[model samples]
Each structure stands twice: as C-alpha cells, then as structure tokens.
Target: MAHLLEGNFGQGSGFNECLSEHVLLTRFGIGINDPKWISIRLSLFKSITLPGVVSQNTSKLGWFIFIDSSWPSEFISDILLATKDFEFIKIIKVNFYFEYYIISEKLIAKSIDFYGRCLVSKIDDDDGISLDCFDVLYDLRGDFFACVFSSGYEFLCQNRIFKPSNMPFLTMNTHFDMRSLDDLKYLRIGHHRVAEFIDKERRNLHVQDEGRFWVYSRHKYSDSRFSAVRKSIVDDKKSRVISSADYHHFSIDFSLLQEFRSQSALLNGVPNEKTWLRQADLNEEAEKIYRQLVSMKRVIDEVGADVIQ
Candidate 1:
C-alpha cells in the first residue's frame, strides 16, 4: 500500500490528469510544499498511518510513501527520521511529471518477481486500518479479485467523536491473479469505481459490521466539502467518544493526534488570505460538475443505457 503526500502523480498523462493536479493545488491554497501543510501531514502520517502498519499482525507487507521531489531538505529529513525505524516503509521521491500507475505496475512486478503473486492495497494518509488487515489479505492471496473491508468509522476531530459508518468501497486491494502486468484491464482503478469497472464475480466486498476495522479521520485539512457534510451528518447521529480501546485496536498514538490538532491550530490563518478565496471558485466548479452529472442521469433515466451508449 502507498500514501501520497503531495506526490506529483498523473502529470505525464492526459488533460484529465492536469485538471486533477490543478484542482488539488487550488484546494490547498498554500502550495503543496508549504511548511505548515507538510508538517501537519507528516505528523499525521507518523502518529496515525505508520502506527497502524507497524502494529500489523504480520511484518511482510511493504508501505511505500510518495512525496514531491522538490520538498526542502529539512522536510525530507523529518520524514526519513520518522520512517527510519521501520525497514518495510520506503520513501519514494517523484518529479513533477511522474505517472501514478507506474508505481502500481512497479509494485506488482516486485511482488511477482519475489513471490510470483500480487495483492496491492492503499490507505489514505490520515486513515488507519485494523491490525489484522494484512493477515486477512494474505489468507486470500490466491484469489483473483478486488477486496474491501467496507465497514468503518468516521472520526471527527473537533469533538473527538466516532460515528459508525460504511465508507464507499475504500480501503481496497486488487488481486490480479496473474503473474504478469500485460493486458491488465483492471489495474488499480479508483477505489470508489472498482465495483463499477470490475464484474461482480471478481469483486469481494467483506462487510465487517461487528468490529469496525478501519478509521477514517475528518479534520480541517482534508477536503472541506466532504468533511463538512460528514460533520453535519455526525452532529445529529448518536456518536461514541473515542477511547483507548479504539486507539489500541488501530495501534495509533492518542497523544500524536492531540499534537496534530495543536499544530494545525497554530498554522490556521497563516496562509495568504487571498488563497482562501479559491474555496469560492472550487465551490462554483463543484456545482457545475454536479449539475452536469444530474443532467446526465436525467438523460439516462429518460433514454435508457443502451440509447445513451
């Protein structure tokens, strides 16, 4: 699995990739390499992401973290220091125009070269998975499909609350069930779209309602629109206070989360005020996209899928 922290991905591809890059930069307002943003993300990665992987039942899995090549020396040093203790965690530096899928292909090649099979997965930079997640994946290594642990919690930082929610098909792994990458039609599609692109027979959706294995964090630094929606929904729901039990399950350090919040507070409002204006532009663009999607759906409903095709 990999975590992208300001990694220059999809730049070598088509126009869509360029638009994706622009959108991310516009969202952050402060540039991706801003000291405060890097500091917060690295802190989160160490306190949340790394701990989960380190405490996994099995130590055989590799966690690759990608960062922008232009990051300052001190930022690189901090990341290196944080990850140095874990031998399995590798830090990769990519230039401005790196193709994201090449990393996936390279990972598959490594797995096939060493073990003759591949099961690839990813986690968000601020998310944590169950301690036994890798063990579960290893058991199903021989299968050819996309695997998902759909049930999880969304933790809102402001109130330190945990609301039971089923995330949309994230925390996924693709088992190609083949030794080579050639003609790989379903090679690491977006987690949300995996079910759509892959047939039902090849998709394994494991619903874990009893023990919520994954935790999705919602804080200010995350994309605001989705986080705001989740916060509003969580406000009305019956939520449980986060406790030691939850942290122990994910092997996350509670103090680190506190530290992250403290640092984020200090960095808030430090960015250029004009940069915040981009949020308005982003909202406008989002509305346009939503309207287009609604129009498309209405057309589909009226004319049917065959006619649209």
Candidate 2:
C-alpha cells in the first residue's frame, strides 16, 4: 500500500506548516570497493536494505541513499530495477573511488538542508528498520539534538559466521537535528564517527531502549566502531559471534547470497550476511512488489506541493 506516487513531495499545510514539519534524513551508503565486492553488496541490498524503508507505516518524508559510482553496470542496473517505483528514494552518487569519511560527510551534508530544522537518521544499506521506524523516530525526536535507538537484532557477523544477538542488544540507532551538523568535530567525519562526538551533543538527546526499531547487521563493512579498539565498543559488544548456531530471528537468506558469491568472484574478503532480505529470493508474490518499486527517473522527480499522505 505504501508504493511511491507521482507528484510534488510537499505537505499541503501551507509554507509555514511544511517548514515546521520535522524532516528526516535516512543515510544509507554502500562503501566503494572492487567490482565483485560491490556486486555482492548489491545483491544483499536488494534483500536486506531497501524493503524496511519503502514499506514504512507513516507519512512520507525525506530519505537519501548514497552509493559509489565505481560500482559495476549490472549492479547499478539492478539498483535502478528495484527502486524504480519509489520516487522519494534519492540516490546521491560519489563519483570516484573511495574516501571513507569524505564520502560519508558529503552524503550526510548534501542530503540535508542545514538551514532547515531537520532530523537525520542513518541506516546502512545492509541494515533495516521495522515498518513504523520513521513514525516512531519522528514522534520521539522532538527538540532533540541527538538520539540513539535500541536495535532488536544484531546479527553478529565475524569470520563468515552468524550468531544472533537478540536480547541485551546494541543501542545503534542514531539521529540528530540539522543544527547539530554544524559542529566541526563530527560534520566532516565518517557516518559512524558521530558516536564519538555524540556525547558532547546529548543534552536534548532521546534514548529509546524498550523495543527493536531496526535490525543492525553487524559486519566488517558496517559503519560503526571505526574509532574503537576492535569495533567492540559499539553497545559494548566484547566478543565475536557467540557460539554460532543456526538461529533465525531477522529476515535473512543465506543460500542466495552464498550462491551469488560462489558464482561470482567475491569470496576473498567480505563475509556472508545471512539475514531476511525478502527481495533476494523472489517468488511470484515477492517479484510483484519488487517490480512495483519505482524507477531512477521517478526517484529524481520532486514532490512540490501536497504532502505525501
């Protein structure tokens, strides 16, 4: 029911009301790497990343996705294929190889209108949120400069094995006002660096620890713990995959991902992420929704007057 519709992306309440409505920025980026590596992530993204977003059970708002321009033609093509129906899903590409922090900085900076009163939420392309994630974040983020939401599922991915960390999960959801982006300490750093600088700006921060608003796919490529000793400081994750057992909680599909890896040349470094990505292995029913997600042209088109209802 939440398919992307054509027209202007504005709330119909007049200019002032639209201005006052809290805008959100959801930052999702796939770090640039080799062609095959990029391909692997592309596959996972189709399954794990995009769904939890487009299906949000709330008023339509702002969402920005940053991607690498260096990714292969097929990879890019698939991105276009899947997102063709969602007009609001903006794809801002970093044209060139990699500069981790710089790329992230630009993604966040450009996606947001710093002059406006905006609340930005960062979700990795590999992770996902529940259907009502935006609604909850928007409601609870009132007057807060920063906030951290509790993660429901942390797929502890290490050495290519998975151990689900459910209860006693990680507090990984982070978001803040556009004004907070003015700080020199974190504005220019990588997306994950906000944790280091967040403490300084938490006076009006909101903390949600009761429910799992999103799924945190913990892996090497995930944008957390760059400054920590061993990426273990995030929500105090002290150890690696705690006794790998065949546990299933988050929506993950391991076989399709493995098959893609075995078929392609992407087995050197990246670990296999086994999470429910509904779009990965599409049946007739799944394929119908997959095909309905909008095109790149629709994604670029703007919502000018009426609010998304």
Candidate 3:
C-alpha cells in the first residue's frame, strides 16, 4: 500500500513529527517576526511532489526519487521517510532560491558533482534601486566553481535583480560579467549548457532600460576575461581542487565586501572605473556585506559548539 502526507507537518511528537527539529525550534523559539527565516527552513521541503508506486508481494521494494534541483541531506531524509514505500518515484521539478549550500550538500553527498561556471552580472532594473546580485565564480586556484550569492536579498546596486517575495537573495560568484542576452546565449551554446535556462524572452520584456544597457556592456566586459581565467585554471598543474566543504567555509570567510571585492578583482579582474565608482557611491553595500559575513560565522560557531557538546 502507498500513503502520502503533506502540509506544515505541525509542531508535536509522534506522527505529527514530520518536520525537522531545527524548524520546530526556530518556529516556536524565534517566533514569526521574520518571514524569511520561516521560508529558509520550510520552503525547501514543502514543494516536494512525489508519486508513489507499489506492487503486491514486494516487501523488498526500493524506490528512486528524482528531484529537479538538489536538496539538502536532512530534507531528503525527511522526504524519503515522509513518502515511504514507492517502487518507482519521480520528483517532477523543483525551484531553489538563495540556498546553494543546501543544494551543494545534497549533490556532493550523492556524488553528482556539477559546477555552474562562467557567469556574469548585469543590471535588471533601475529606480536608483539596489538589488542583490548572483553569479557563478570560478576559483582558479581551486579549479572549482563556488556559487555565492548575497547573504540577504538587500538592494545595493541600482540595476540588479530584486529578491522575489518567495525567494532568498542568494547570488553566485564569478569573475565574468554577464550583462547581455548575447553573453548568456554564448554560454548556453557552449559545453557548459545545462537544462536550466533563464527564459530571456520573458526577462527582456520586463527588465528596465538602463538594466538592459548594462547587461549588454557586462557581456562585453566578461567574455575575454572568462576565457583567460578558464584556461589558466585548467592548464595550471598547481591549481587547488576545492571541495564542497571548503566552498562552504570560503563563503563564510569571503562574505565581507573587503574580502569579496579584493578576491573578486584578483580572480576575475579589476572592476572598471564605472563599476568601482558606482559601488563607492553605495556606502551601505560594504556594511551589509560585513554584517552578513558576521552572521554566517556566528551560525558556524554555534553549529560547531553544538557538535562538541
């Protein structure tokens, strides 16, 4: 027989204990002052749509759950148990926002390691609005791509993508500047093409004028640089191979603006005059980055203490 259970899973013991303990602790202890906090822990597991298949006299039944996007280990475990006893299973699709670590953890554990390398940032809109940016950053020394995003979806740049109401403001790190549709087209045409596409047609219709222009310039800026960096990283015998864990730690370490900008310039190339001046004008950007780094470090320290205890 096959059974399926869905909902918040509530706060209680026994059958009502479908949710993670971390979630219960946060929901009750922290309360709902921050809606984003609630989404961070719950959104990952809530969208799971699984189909359970069962056969008669098959007590030794095994099932495969296919997820469109990678899932965290804890979340996956919960889901497997939550939807038990399925012969053939498939997770039609899933979407992730501002949670690359969770995605990375799941993929690395499953041995399906893939990197989204060679990405650039472009402006998406302008109202003198600052938005969180995400891009794919390749570590030449490590020869791995670290998907870094803004720790919080805070607006810092005039032309950038805003964090969706339902999504976290995570960005990826990259040396390349991807601002134009043409640049993205080149990426899609290359060997790096994955099933994921950004739906440029839709984006073009809604994205603002200044944002579009900046996107065009960004593509021009990053193309040659990306090629050079990729070649250097690949050919260098001394390049370091970064593991998932290292990437996680690196994210915490480099979350600050001083670290991020310095390292970014070293890895990708120095920011152009316009880019530099623009960043300088936004005084709050640096402070926001610093706060995020500190917050992440605190989380790490707490987790470590808990482990030791």
Candidate 4:
C-alpha cells in the first residue's frame, strides 16, 4: 500500500481529486456507446471565448490550436491535411466565438515601426493604394498573421480563450532588446583575456600555498602576459585590474558559493555546454562556467534564488 501510494502520488493529484469529488460521475453513467456524454465532459474542459468581451490582460486565448514550433514544416502540413475535417474548425470557432470586432489600428502601427512593414491598410480608393501594394504589404505581414492564427488556434484547442497576443496588431507599441554592435564586438575578447589571466595567477598561488618542499617551478614563469593583454583593453580610467585571488575568494564566500553550487547543479546534464566546450574549439570551459556563475548572481539579485530552492 505504501509503495502504491508513493507511485501514484504526483503533482496536481489534489486538484484532480477535488474536481472528481465535485462533479457527479453518476449523472453520466459509464456507457461505452454514448458518445454525447463523452462530448459534454470534453466540452467542460474546453476553453470558451466570448465575442465583445475585452479579455483581462492575463488571458492566454486560443494558442493551443497550432502545431508545435519544433515540429518540421512538412509534418505540420501533413497534420493540417489529415485534420481538414470541418468539425475541427467548428471546435475552434466554438472555443473562440467573439461577437464584437476589436480594431487595433494602433497595434498595427507599432508592428510596422518595429518590423518595418504594414499589416493593416485603409480600404478607401482615394489613398492611391493599388492591389499590388496591398499584396506586397500582406505578404510581408502574412508570417506575423499566421503566427497569431496558429497561437490563437492552439489556445482554442487547449480550451482557453482570452489569451491576448503579446504582439497585438493595430497597437503601435513594441518591445525589443537593443544592444550596440560595438558592445557585442568587444565583449568576448574582453571577458576571455580577463578571466584567463586571473585563473593562471590563482593556480600559481595555490601551488605556493600548498607549502611543498620543492621550489615552485610553475611560479617562475609570469602569467603577466595574459594580464597585459587584458590591461590594454581597459580604455576607461575608472577600470581597474582584478586579480584571480579576488575572484577565487569571491566564489568561496557563503553567498556566492551557494549560488555557484546551484548553477552547477542546474547545468549538470545540459548537452549544449558539452558541445560548446568541446566542438566549438573554445578551450575555456572554466571561464564559461565562471561567467554563468556570475550571470546567476545577477538573476538572484532580480529574483531571490532562495525562492527557487
């Protein structure tokens, strides 16, 4: 019984139990031939969207109806062909039935600003816009519309309506993470040289601190060459050189050490790290690991890492 309980007990079982308790199973008796009863139960779990209801900001309307992005295009095409039954279309419509049209001219304007293309065009003839112009514009924004449709469809399929598009057409507001090209160009070289110089010096200190009788042969050679390269890149007067000892000590500190351990655990089986360290010809796994540790520190600052634990 203990083994059975242990095997059966899993996340979200409590909610399932509550649902089963509230819903009278006897009302729809177990009848294998009665398809309508099955349909009614399925509909209960299906997401319902009403027209003209300005959904709350948190709604995840009709997104589960689309194919997964990881699925190959050919596979998706085949799925669409196989599931061409009008009943499926009706299901989608039932899930996302909207009575009132919501115009988003402002949203469309924003998309044009960020994407450098228009999706919505005026129907008036006096605008001098030809069908060719409309076609070209539509072609450019078609990908965007398709994405929206796919997301909407998925939401409906999952029985959820009120899922708002993050990039709503007709809204002129856009969000983007913009970084200067110059900043990106120097980031890799700057970080690499600095970390390498620090690591070598730390290793030499570790050898000396071990207090072996033999003279430190490795200590005779100055790791200063790497340090010099790093210093040369420091154009800002305020920038100062940080030693490997400083970083080593920082890593061992109670707060930082705890974070390092957590990050190391998180990265344990990630294949990308192995590929990056081995195949990418980047012989700086230690440096990469340290960089990730530093990034985790920043994340901890934004959202307390204790919460995750």
Query: Largest lDDT belongs to which candidate?
Result: 1
Better of 3 and 4 by TM-score: 3
Can you write out model 3's per-residue Cα lDDT over 151-237, one digit (the tens) per residue? 322211111122211111111111122332344342223222221233333221111112110111111122345444445444555
Residue 294 local lDDT, model 2: 38
- Model 4 spans > 4 angstroms off: 1-184, 187-283
- How does residue 33 of candidate 1 score in lDDT? 56
Off by over 4 Å in 1: 1-31, 171-179, 182-188, 200-210, 269-309
Model 1, poorest ten-residue lDDT window? 19-28
C-alpha TM-score for every candidate: 0.70, 0.56, 0.16, 0.13
**For model 4, how does the per-residue alpha-carbon lDDT over 170-223 read when each residue is reduced to its tens digit?**
111111111222212111222225235334434211111111111000000112
What is candidate 3's TM-score against the reference? 0.16
Show where candidate 2 strays beyond 4 Å: 1-33, 96-115, 156-172, 180-196, 218-309
Q: Give the local distance difference test score of model 3.
A: 0.25
lDDT for each of the candidates? 0.58, 0.47, 0.25, 0.22
lDDT of 1 by residue, 88-190 (tens): 5556565421223445455555565666555556666677777876666566555545556667777776457888777657643222343556524455455
Better of 1 and 2 by TM-score: 1
Clashes of each: 0, 21, 19, 30
Ranking by lDDT: 1, 2, 3, 4
The alpha-carbon root-mean-square deviation between model 3 and the true structure, to one decimal in Å, is 22.4
Candidate 1 local Cα displacement, residue 305, angstroms: 51
